[model samples]
Target: MAKVIEVDPEGLRSWIGSAKRTLTIESEAMARLIQALDGPLGRAFGEAIRLIKQGSGRVIMTGMGKSGHIARKIAATLASTGTPSFFVHPAEASHGDLGMIGRDDIIIMISNSGETAELRAVLDYAKRFQVKMIGLTSRADSTLSHHADVALCLPDCREACPIGMAPTTSTMLQLAIGDALALALLEDRGFNAAQFKTFHPGGLLGAALTHVKDFMHKASQLPLVAPTTPMAEALVTMTQKSFGCLGVVDGESGELIGIFTDGDLRRHMSRDLIDLTVSDVMTRTPRTIVSDTLASEALEILNSTKITSLFVVDDKNRPVGLVHVHDLLRHGVQ
Candidate 1:
């Protein structure tokens, strides 16, 4: 048997109080950050964006300790959002990683005090190579701010830590600034979901961003028949295709006009059903989606309409493919 731990009610209350205080402090710090963005920080931010967008080479991120962790996350966000970027440790740069910095590259160096000793080599290298440097520091007059092409000064704020030493609110501000920068660049480049899917292609995010065309059954795989097609033949094709639905097309134009589903089958159930044509029971103007539609949107349509599948249509309203809810599920799309 596992040993049960005793709970201290009073201690628990104290812990909760501490947590709330921390949240309040951090929230206040973030509010100050909003004001900070409207001043010189804002101008430097715009300059950094222009440098990054204009640069032909990748963005190089470097920092030390807690700052390094935040830098890595920022680099990842930028890389995933279409801006090429990578993190290089400041210490490692002094050894040999400085070679990673080139004249065309943009360097974003993060340090709360703007005086992290490990960053000296990276700073000197950027200066020597004429690499554009964007400094993220709380001190406006620090060495980093002086040497950087653009210095984004962080708003002075209290740390959430009880000792007021550990990075808490400051790191949060850094993270928010990094996200803002990445999104600004994303919008500047007109990055879209389809382009985002190219970078994230192996998880729930990837599945959500995936286009309908990727999961759609196309060409011969579509369970299609003409409005004039015999009900018996259409039923056979629907069964053989195993899609539980059949598309009806205009024989002359080859454009989708209606769809035959299980609901229609039950509505027209009778002894003379097989003798009728597909047009006799098919539902007209069926819900459809374009190939560029996201799979996540397709799932929403399936859930909202309480249906299992949808047809992918071209600009001409011709049925190009079919996407089933099962296809979305199998690919990890919610």
Candidate 2:
């Protein structure tokens, strides 16, 4: 337990000033990272990315202490994005987890000093197993750096700790370097949002949110009326479906002729309601989206036109579905 110390504005201000000075060290370290970007280390990173892409098996990242934590995060990010990856602690690997390493796996080991005894043994064993090796570190001259098939060196940066001992800016650069590799691989693989959704399909955030067909009411579910139908009939169909609208189509080929809505009904109140036909009452070929389109697109259509619903159609101009504002909201589509 610690006692609470009395402090005032001046003490707080001095603390703020000290914190502000740390930002300068971080900035200067980031600048030094640019220099390391052009050396053999850069070539090594390119090779590591290539090896992971071309390799038939998964990627295994391992490290000790702060590096181990970073390795775990890097593994997770890579696994989520496009690559299959997992973390192995150097100490744990030394104990028994070494059995998890496979011949076809790409091994990425991270360390600031690159001389942790446990990591060195892991690297040595990995070489015998013929697993491809990638090393990340600040000191290129370290034994771990020398033994790696690919060595990624970080720029020299001052630790923000008062004694200059804690891993601060070093961790940032390590994480950033891993990000660069993962993102570079992602771009090269042409990984898009649609592909990303295949790996993550829960919480209503899947690719289904992006495609309109997943949320739109299809075929018979779509509210529609014949062109010769009365305006009153269109209102009844639209209201029953609760889509705020109805598509008017021809009897033969089901091609869209027009659309009628609550707005159309409001404007035609003075006319003889009984004599009003969809042909005389409907708006011409109202705005619509294709079945394969995104649900967010339906929201866009509604917003841009100041309407609450859109008719979804297929290639032959046949009404396929109806998408309403409520539907997008229900599906969590923004």
Question: lDDT winner among the candidates?
Answer: 1
Q: Which run of 10 residues does model 1 get worst, by summed lDDT?
A: 94-103
Give per-residue CA lDDT, model 1, range 115-204, as digits (tens).
999999999888887999999999999999999999999999999999998999999999999999999999998999989989988889
Clash numbers, per candidate: 0, 0
lDDT of 2 by residue, 35-104 (tens): 6678776777788888888888888999999999999999988998899999988888878889888898
Q: What lDDT score goes with residue 81 in model 2? A: 84
**TM-scores of all models?**
0.94, 0.85
